[model samples]
Target: MAEFFNSISRRKFLLTAGASAGTVLLAGCLGNPPEDVGGNAAAPTTAQPVANISSEQAPETTAVKLGYVPIVEAAPLIIAKEKGFFAKYGMNDVELSKQASWGSARDNVEIGAAAGGIDGGQWQMPMAHLITEGVITKGNKPIPMYLLAQLITHGNGIAIADKWQGKGVDLKLSSALVSQVKADGKGGSRFKAAHTFPNVNQDFWMRYWLAAGGVDPDNDIDLLPVPSAQTVANMKTGTMDAFSTGDPWPYRIVKDKVGYMAALTADIWKNHPEEYLAIRADWVDKNPKATKAILKGIMEAQQWCDNFDNRQEMANILSQRQYFNIPVDILIDPLMGKYDMGNGRKIDDRTMAPLYWKDEKGSVSYPYKSHDLWFITESVRWGFLPQDYITNNAAKAKALIDKVNREDIWKEAATEAGIPAADIPTNTSRGVEEFFDGVKFDPEKPEEYLRSLKIKKANV
Candidate 1:
């Protein structure tokens, strides 16, 4: 994976140069300077149609340093640029920087303090921790974060190496593989699974999937923390046996025929909130207008990506060396809702390609409070936080969670962007409306849900 990334990096450098030349020509024709083509620009007060906007209206942040990785799920960011959504919204100066790892992206956002950073999935729990603990920014100061918007949901999957083939481990075929792991003695076949971070969405789904299958993730297997970009190679080299990560990685494994997608994380929790556009709390507080403008640009990008016609274009951009660096064939399957699992399982469900604002009304409905509670429960279940910590520090934790005003921020931005406010989800306690098997989540009672589970819980 590292080698692949290195090759991708070089390819992106060349592509960036080439793309820059084209941007220059386009800028000249538009009577806009090249410098305003990519970074921070002045914010706009009123909404504007993406198609009619000009570079002169572009925000001053052109050299805007936005961080992202090369995953199929991150199509909105790619589409926004490819389809000129950002340019339409006056984000003409936006520049994308492909970070080496998720950690790198998060760290860069913290240190560089750019406009915002993209998360592989809804990492509300970890982001909450970051705010309270001051690990990334000052804790007491509390970096106010905003959910610019959701990229897509249900695009992530879990892949197990080919060695596990014929072991009847197919996710669609059965949950027998999970049972086998449970039957394995202490450490459960010593299976190793990698995730980008402990607090991200993959971690939540990975742990929940195991527990749902009657396996205690913390005890049944060894969970290794690895960057999402390295998951595939780690599995190939035997450093790990399975991994739950976002698109292109798992899809790449299937393409290589070296691994089989054991389960789609979306299957574990369909329509699950995947990635989010998170910015420093302070940044939002200080640049409310600018923040809204950025959100407008991102919202436009999300709309462009949700259009079926744009899938091919999105895949093409991500396949370029400057972005995902993977073959377009590998990237397109998951993005287009066509799945070819190496184990002879094929899926054509549109559910696979979760979009940001597809429904406009349904997609951006409500911020599921249950989603946040689920992560908190998982943190406790996994010992990332002490049992008493949640209870004793309930006030602090709640304050941290409250700092992420998804409802207010999303509503305001969506309204400003001409997205109907009625479309926003009104029930904050319901985390996700649907799970893989059609289970609904009620975030209001996360503790009860956790206590009902048979999985092992550390005595705290």
Candidate 2:
């Protein structure tokens, strides 16, 4: 049995009187999915048939409006909708609706239970963890959330403008970035860097990148909150020195011939889980069969996304205005892992691509509890959540992790979808992971990891 759910239950997590009454009243709000829910049901996109008729594939809730922000990271969920995977598995009424921003996506889901407009979406993993801890609340009440699975990994980057491009700012290799920043500081220049949002994947990775190079992210660099879509424009206008953000943005800069990728976040940590499908716990509780169906379809889409042959076409499909809205040409290099750093250097390698399925490290989609603990640890380090995110330290952290990991649901859905047991992680961890700067994040010593950080907020 899932111990976290056993201890708290879904009702206690979401329905604490305030959020409950409104959600109960708006329970019948879902109408349909997005406009792309139609088309060939048997189009044979990439993933082969994984399930034979089984009770596990049966969906309870037929319609759901999952929110999204335009980025290629939303690929798996989009593919599940476009390729008819959702329809094939009985969720014929799935819509991949667009949200205005990351914060918007969060609010949409937090109020989803009461408003009943949005059921789930590809969201930041750490933010979901924060919601569970009651840090990211609605009406001062904890909004219960469940991360069913990870959407994409490493489809993001850190990039710099023309000002620092040829000045040698490459992060992966030894560069003069630190020296340049120090010189600039002495010369009365303040270096600024931006990322998508605070307390999320991009923020953590960007800070980790800057800190690794002996620069205090908070104290040394003037950090800016540049949205992913506007990152390139801001960089072009010299709004910030550089940025850490999702795909197409990084690639868009290089395509515009004004900037270059400093480092792909994947190079920081391969197979790192980025965004996750944060579903309201109330939605998951009410739609058990439907939830599994959604997971199976997404798992299959993930498998399809991991397929080597499908990547090129997938990138092209993601470029449509309905999705990422970037041109197909710019997305190809990033999506295909054909990186051009724009510093007279080019890399034609697959390691940096935002892989979906199993690579040498292991499956990228597994919702490992270890990943959760690491996210929580980072969230605390950055003041995104309270230092005492849990009252009992590691024990409380583990309990919160157990509450939201949902690997059991992932394994069950994967198995029902005819996926191999090997793909499903038996252990909660991917072992002790080492970042690009050689800092080891051992999930067991989360509190110790928090203490080891050089740059952190006042509260933590």
Candidate 3:
């Protein structure tokens, strides 16, 4: 038995904000985490004001509302707000709202298009790209979005129900398992494996995982969208047989004895880009100082989160009703580098942990253009973006990527935060990313990568 789960108590979600000028809480799933989870105990000392803007200078917009989903991946933003990083950079009144769903989260950004609703916070990087193209919008008015920082990498798992326990899906997916699953579905009902959203990292990675097991995600299994929080609950009710989502939820299923982690995404693709702090482009232009402050503060928070000592504290903060709202033990297990894979296999792996700053060069937070290119490629593969973007009109595609891939903002924030230059990537590309399948994504030759996939629209 995994001794860790025994120590945690089952709990319900509660939303309480601390009573202070800098801290405020709201009702339901996410208004703010408690004082500790909201901010660091000590604020970073090296947050230099942008353009000689002194510490006493006020933010361009004194009050800003940021939206985030209730998950551990949203930790950096919460930590920045809680730790006084927002206030430190002159954001006097920063409100962190826990969004109900991804579509709601995207709509809030569209609300920002009016110049007042939400300036920016953690969102799907693909949504950031698609929003710029008016793909998912309210008025077909494209909102240019910029990625300031990466929240976490490879911290999710694809969990399958207990019925499929020893069918060889844990850690590595099995073809036999896929065939069995497909055959088990009655009538015209499709075997479903829910991911958080379509045209996003979770969808792409989940597709790859399913495909690796010889399952055609589009045909053999219906890849549906389920809110992250509801994924485990639906799995419990057998609404979904499997789901690929951020940490704690996957672990939640295992704890309930309803599911087991079938494949660790980190093991499928190590140090891969996961989620990011994407600001609306116009917002970045108008509030350069405040924007830089947000990035710098969150960057420091990212480092704070990666530290081994802070895992339990992070779990505690997320456990409060205002955030993740799960038991502390379930939340902390993945953070502490332990995984109960639900198939009676336990593995201690750091690579599978939420990767933050891995030195300057290995920093997971840097908004690499190649990572965005991978997003575009995968998106286009699934017919999310135009096929021409991957072929004859690749430059137009590059330009679109350049518009959203804000490497400059990241480097500036790092320098202001006193993170050494060595930690920053000199170039936007992170070279070729090798996956467990022996395939490599050459940032320079993305077209080659797009052509290599066995089951993509590009290939078709």
Candidate 4:
């Protein structure tokens, strides 16, 4: 179990003025109990203002409403708001609303900030892409969105109910155990699994784990979308066999003894692309300066979050009543790359933990167009998208990725924020990515990668 911060007062979200004067305000509805302020007590220092943001770079608007699911992936956004990073870069009136579910975030983005919805905040893999093409939008009405930055990597895992403990349903399932699982799903009890929302990050993670173990996710299991909180409850009732999501829910399972994590996403794919920060395209187009300002704020926040020393404080801030609404203890281990998997397994490697800024391969905050291609290709593998999307008609897919992935803006923000040149990748692709199952995806030839897959819906 993780230790609690020395003195944490129960509190609710509050709005306050910015750190400096001159018409700037914090503008965020966040908790700020004096007891919860500051980073690690060992190295406490006053938060610094973002330098180099001249008057010319001031945002067109200081206020924007953004929605976020209360996963660790959204920490940068909350950190930016709580630590005054957003206000430091002229995003003074940014509102961080806790969304009920990923579905709610999707619906909110469609209506946008003008109406009672969000401009955008944290999103799962390929959500911004799908929303751009209107594949998962309301009535398929095509609500275009821009992919800004990847929020964090490796904070997620696939959790199996305690009933399956020691049943050989781990990172790699045995052939005999795979047959047993398939048989267990007979007579309409099909091994029901879930993700927060379907056809995206969580869903893909669950499906990949299953398929990699030779369990046909489509035919052998009943995979569906269930809200993260509800999935925990369902697991307790034995109604759900498994679920894939980010911390601190998975940590809650281990703490509450509801389930055991079969595999951390880190084990499946090291430093994989997780959730993202995106906004409505219209909002970005209307306020380009404001868009970059938000990016700069989040960029600084990501850098702050990557520091292990500040994770304790990060956990403390996120556990307030208005954020994740959980005990701070549940967050500490995962944030530090420690896991009590609730089975006989344990992981204490910091390198395998969630990373926000830099990782082994490079920048975790920069959105690579190649990563977008992988998500689209995975969608094709699972039949969420057609084969023509990436297999037969590759250029069409790249066109969509080019339009939606705003890496140029990320480069602009990096330069404006004084990010070192080596830190900013020169190419849109992160080169070829390899998975735990020996599957490799090369950005240059996505179709070949698709063809290498043995179990896929794509006609390649």
User: What is the clash count for each candidate, in the order shown?
Assistant: 31, 3, 9, 0
- Put down candidate 4 lDDT per residue, 163-261, tens digits, no spaces: 988878888988987897788667556788877766788888998899889888888888766666676678899999888888877777878888999
RMSD of every candidate to native, in Å, equals 8.3, 7.9, 8.4, 8.4
Across 1-460, the per-residue lDDT of candidate 2 in tens digits comes to 1233223322232211101111111111122323233221112234323334556457877788887666767888877776657766777677776666665565677677347557777887676776666655544357778888888878888888878755656775344667667666665578888777665777888888887777777766687666565666777788778888777778778888878888888788877888888788888888888888888888878888888788766765665545655556676777777988877768787877877766668878888888888887776676555566633566777778788777888888788777887777888787788887777888877766666766666343
Q: Give per-model TM-scores.
A: 0.78, 0.85, 0.85, 0.90
Give the TM-score comparing model 2 with the true structure, all chains together. Answer: 0.85
Q: Write candidate 3's Cα lDDT for 291-320 as tens digits.
A: 877777677778888888877666666665
Off by over 4 Å in 3: 1-58, 113-116, 181-189, 359-361
Q: Using TM-score as the measure, which candidate wins? A: 4
What overall lDDT goes with each candidate model? 0.57, 0.70, 0.70, 0.81
Judged by whole-model lDDT over C-alpha atoms, candidate 4 comes out at: 0.81
Worst 10 residues of 3 by lDDT: 6-15
